[model samples]
Target: MSIRKVVFPVAGLGTRFLPATKVIPKEMLPVVDKPLMQYAVEEALAAGITDFIFITARGKGVIEDHFDKAYELETELARRGKDDMLERVTDFMPEGTTSIFIRQQEALGLGHAVLCARAAVGNEPFAVVLPDDLIAGNGRNVMQQMVDVYDRQQGSVVAVERVPKDQTDRYGIVETGELQERVAPLTSIVEKPKPAAAPSNLAVVGRYILTPRIFELLQNTRTGAGNEIQLTDAISALLAEESIYSYEFDGTRYDCGNKLGYLQATLNYGIRHAEVGEAFREYLDGWNNSRDS
Candidate 1:
């Protein structure tokens, strides 16, 4: 089946972004002109996903509002004859794509957040994209790449990247079986294993195309590390029954959840904008030269 629905877990308190995030949802943080979540939504849209299941929290009402039509803004823009800007702003969601919102009252864990969308996902396979992990590439979106693998293999798939061995403890490390270029068939997954005990350097990123069986696994998943229901645990359980594929995406992934990665993504996207690239490049050049001096 074609991947038509995507689940976005936007319930985290974003503790990393203190004061500012105290009021605003971290996913609402501006990347350039648009919020970070907008990028993820756009990426999913590009991958042909027509349904959105946002597992949001209390402060995440702004996210739903962001995608909704703003009558006041539209009227003001139309009165001012600002059709171009209005079109740009209002064209976020395409027609015929269904968007559903569900509240994940408690901030349990990624697995729990996903399970909250079980009703919407039903028994079909669905995609999950973490807005915190902003990925950019020349061609396919990361989830789209995984979906292609799922189409062929008819099972679960996850996006993986090779992290340093020393950093294995920071991510869900996977043991490899058959290697198909950047795509690897998974044998098993170990959540945050020590560097010396890491199965392989391939660490799971935030993108996943999961089967409905995951919801069943998550329903019974016991709280593991950090006293939270981890998605990795459920995924490990799924691995025991089904074949899972991992694809090393050809793209730049920015962990917007981290301060440094957020800044890096801001600069990278800013420097690539047609309207700002030249000016931003010159400013960076001057700044670098001054720092060196």
Candidate 2:
């Protein structure tokens, strides 16, 4: 069966973004005109995911409202004869697609947040996407690549990218055993290992195609780094009984969880945006010239 379900873990405190994130969820932060969470949802839809499950915490109700039907806004736009704006809200959600919101209830780690959606996911393979990691692909969307990998392998697949050896400790590093086309059969995964102990520079990123069994493994997993239950640790345990592959998906991923990555994403997407591209590029050129002088 095709992977039809996806879990979005949006319960993070956004501590990195301090005062702004105190009220606004970092996922709601925009890259140009689209928010990170909207981009993630659109990517999943492109991958043919039928169910959208959002595991959120307190102060995240805005995300639910954002995805929900805005009847009042649409009606007002129609009354004002703004068909373009009306169509935008009317078409915000895909036809025949539905969304489910689950409460995480507590400030837990990624693993716990994922497990909160166990009921919504049921007994099927699903994709897990972190909205903070806004990945844009050239030919196909990021989740589409993972879905394609899942079709052939029928096992779990993760989107990975090579990082510098010294930076390996910043992410969950994996060792490649053998190649299954573009997908690498993972031999082992070490969470935040030091540079000297890192097996490889391949760092696991946000996108993941996981089997239902992950819920079981996550349930038994003990807290690791930062005293929070780490999803990388749970996946490691699943490796003994099952096969999990990592594929370096074709994409330029923006780490929008922090300030720098967010700004980078804004600049990158801004220059490519059809409405603002020309003006934005001109502005950038002028700013660069001034800085040089």
Candidate 3:
């Protein structure tokens, strides 16, 4: 079946961002001119997803508003004849695409956040994109690449990338069976294993194309690491029942949830922007030369 719907768990308090995130959501933070969440949304759209299920919290109304029509801004832009800016703001949501917002009242774990979208997701296979992981790639989007694997295998697939052995404990590390060019048949997954205990360096990223059976697994999933319901636990159960493969997504992922990663993403994207790329390149060159002198 074609994967038409996607779930976005945006309910986290984003405490990492502190004072600024106390009012605004970290997902709303801009990379260059676009917000982080928009990158995920655009990625999903590029991957053929037409329906969006946003599991949001209290202070995340701005997210919904961001994708909606900004009438006042549009009118002002019209008055000033800023047609370019007008198009940019008004083109947030594409026609025929459906967006549904569900409230996740608690700051539960990732598994619980996904379960909150069960009703909207129904029994069909759906994609889950974590906005915190902003991926940069050419051609196919990460989700699209996973969907291609799902199309061939007809099972669940998650995006994985090779992490340093020492860093394996920081992520859900996957044990491999047979490796194709880009896809690896996953044998098992261990969440945050020690460096010596890690089966492989392939770590699961935030992008997932999950079957409906996962919702059931998550419902009965007991608290694991950090006493929070881990998505890895549910995925492990799914792996036991059926085929779950890992795809090494051809992309550069930025963990916008971390302060350093967020700043790096902003600087990287800013330096690549058509409007600022040349000037920013010169600025960096001058700074580097001065430091050397």
Candidate 4:
């Protein structure tokens, strides 16, 4: 079956970004000019996903507003003959795309946020995208690459990247059976294991293409690390029922969940932005020269 629906679990508190995220969602934070959420949505859209299910919480109404039409803003821009600005605001969301926002009442873990979209996702293979992981694809995006693996494996596919062994505690570590180029069959998955206990350095990132059976497993899954439901646990259980493949996606992923990563993403994207790339480069060069002097 063709993967058409995508679930975005955006209900987290984003405590790392505190103060700023107090009002605005972390996903709404901009990298260069575009919001992180927009990038994730564009990636999914490129993968031909039509239904967007956002499992959001309170104060995330801005997210809904961002994707929805800004009537007054559009009208003012149109009246002022700001054709480019008007089009930019109005064209953010594509036609024929269905966006459904469901409130995740509590601050549950990733598994719970995904389970909240059970009704919207129904019983089909769907992709889960976390906007915090801003991936820049060389040609094909991360989600599209995972979908390709899903097409061949026809079970579940998760995106993995080799993190430093010491950083294994920060990610869901995957143990692979054998290396088949970029794709590997997962032998086991451990969530946030210590450096000494980590099975392998292949850490799972935020992109996932999962079958509907995951919802059932998540429902049965008890609280694990941090006393919150973990998606890694459910994916572990899924290994018994079906085969799951881990694809080492080809891309540079910016971990936008923290201040350092956010700044790095901004710098990287600003340097490559179409409108301001050259100017930014010149400014950086002058700044570097002044510092050296």
Top candidate when judged by TM-score against the true structure: 4
If candidate 1 were superposed on the true structure by all CA atoms, what would the RMSD be?
A: 1.1
Q: Which candidate is the best by lDDT?
A: 4
Q: Which whole-number lDDT from 0 to 100 does residue 18 have in model 4?
A: 91
Q: Can you write out model 3's per-residue Cα lDDT over 5-115, one digit (the tens) per residue? A: 999999999999999899999899999899999999999998899999999999899999999888898999999999999988987679989999999987778889999
Superposition error at 262 for model 2 (Å)? 0.6
Give Cα distance to truth, residue 258, candidate 4, Å. Answer: 0.5
Q: How many backbone clashes does candidate 1 have?
A: 0
The 10 consecutive residues of candidate 4 with the worst lDDT sum are: 85-94
RMSD of each: 1.1, 1.1, 1.1, 0.9
Give the CA lDDT, 0 to 100, for residue 62 in model 4. Answer: 95
Better of 2 and 3 by lDDT: 3
Instruction: Write model 2 residue lDDT over 150-205, tens digit each, in one string.
Output: 99989999889999889988899999877666788989998999999999899999
Model 1 agreement with the true structure over 183-271: per-residue lDDT tens digits:
77889997889999988889999999998999999999999877889999999999988888888888999989989999999999999
Clashing pairs in 1: none
Query: What digit string (tens of lDDT, one per residue) describes model 4 on residues 20-135?
Result: 99999999999988899999999999998999999999889999999999889988998999998888788766889899999999876999999999989999999999999999
Off by over 4 Å in 1: none
Cand. 3 TM to true fold: 0.97
